[model samples]
Target: MQLLYEHRSPPRTGRKVALIITGALMVVALLIFPPEGLVTTWSLWALACALQLAGVGLLALPPVIHLWITRREIIIHPTGPVRRLPIQHIHDMELSGTEEDPVLTLHLRNGEELDLSDWTDNVPEVMALLAQLGVARRDA
Candidate 1:
């Protein structure tokens, strides 16, 4: 029996808030520093420019939006390098570490292992998934 499910992670607004704050500060700085003057070099305007680019670049990073898993495989999208393992190839499922920051490990064939705890936002959902997949879910 093989079943797969997908769950969209929660929205993370901290980045948006950070971008807004930084943009506002940059506008204020530009207004005060006057881009026309040679004083830009002396007043660290270059630093502001670098920071703005970095902030915008970070927005391109894809969040942990979807997790697709079945007893045989697990996929994380939209940047998935899907791992395909049959149920028989999954040796064991383990949960370790502190309650607040526990780790979930799936021991696979040929000494391979999978850890999904890092980017996972909702642990309870994953735990339920593991149970459904006959993983013998562990209490964190």
Candidate 2:
């Protein structure tokens, strides 16, 4: 079966809310509390707000992308392009769970570690697929 998935690492929802609120506050400050040189001083803040908004938008793109897994390989399609990695190349899998960050890390035979937590939507499903394909868990 051909299963598709995407890689996405987005700021947490709380982070997004905070960014929006902060940006709004900055906008309000620029409007209500104009500095002596408001135009020049506020321009930088305005630019920063715009950049933050763009980042929020980018964070929303990962769920829309999908990964495809089959007997032969795993395919990850992000916003811009598609990436394919053969099942044979995957040497080990590690599930990273810490107080701060929880992620699934894939270690390839070629000595590459691919972090999938940010992009993968259904991690258990991915784990099942990998297990079925005989991928060993390094952490275990």
Candidate 3:
């Protein structure tokens, strides 16, 4: 596939590693002190577990943080299963929301509309690219 446009977010690997380390330290601290009260111990354990789980979840997430459009498809790089949308399947592109917080909506041929507000901030640029690729906007 021909490369059209790409936008990426900075890496958060270091932050995720730090979170995992912090959670591990919490676990160690709980083991050493064994909180005085039963309720406190349980609370500490819960916190430790939550921290560890959150760290692991973050680590599992995909690193790509923006939309990647090619000649054939629009690849959404978010934490989800439906990542690729074919260009041919897109019926129209629509922009909504306030000017300060614009949202790009993809109206699929099957009638499913995808709100891309959360995935991308470069709304106008993306809209332009899609238009150049011959994907008509809703008004057109």
Candidate 4:
């Protein structure tokens, strides 16, 4: 029941931020310095601007905002502040990758795999916890 790892991931990714900023700048540049006959009507330029913003907005999504690991199981924070997953369906772990960067894949009995970011930062702690709990998981 002891807590092992708790991580609060960032809301926005770096690549997504860069893309959004670049899109905004391009829109500003288009309005300030219009291309020759490319956007003759204000309505056409407005439509383009709307589409750009909409695309960026759709791409902006929070992947893994929070993670909690306990001796019993892992608890991923509820997405959008709602819809908490049950622990009754707790699954087993399948470790992969080299020692330098380990990847943990939790497999449910329903044949669905939980997608987890490489929680490498807490690898040592997790290993120590597993050792304390007398859990030996050797990946082949």
TM-score of every candidate: 0.59, 0.52, 0.58, 0.48
Candidate whose lDDT is highest: 3
Task: Give the distance in Å from residue 51's predicted Cα in candidate 2 to where it truly belongs.
Answer: 21
TM-score of 4: 0.48
> Against the true structure, candidate 1 has what lDDT?
0.65
Considering TM-score, which of the candidate structures 1 and 4 is the better prediction for this target? 1
Give the per-residue lDDT of model 2 (tens digit) for 48-69.
5885796588557444455667
- What C-alpha lDDT, on a 0 to 100 scale, does residue 115 get in candidate 3? 88
Listing every candidate in turn, what is its Cα RMSD in Å to the true structure after a full C-alpha superposition?
4.5, 5.7, 4.8, 5.9
Error of 3 at 32 (Å): 27
List where candidate 3 sits over 4 angstroms from the true fold. 11-63, 78-82
Over all chains combined, what TM-score does candidate 1 have? Answer: 0.59
Against the true structure, candidate 2 reaches a TM-score of 0.52
Predicted candidate 4 versus true structure: per-residue lDDT over 9-110, tens digit per residue: 654555565656666777787779876664464655676676667657756644564666665665666344532333445345566777877776655658
Model 2: how far is 117 from its true place, Å? 0.9
Name the lDDT value of residue 1 in candidate 3: 76
* Candidate rank order under lDDT: 3, 2, 1, 4
Q: Which RMSD does model 4 reach against the true structure?
A: 5.9
Q: lDDT, candidate 2, residue 104?
A: 81
**lDDT winner between candidates 3 and 4:** 3
Q: How accurate is candidate 2 locally (lDDT)?
A: 0.73
Q: Model 2: residues >4 Å from true position, as ranges?
A: 4-63, 98-101
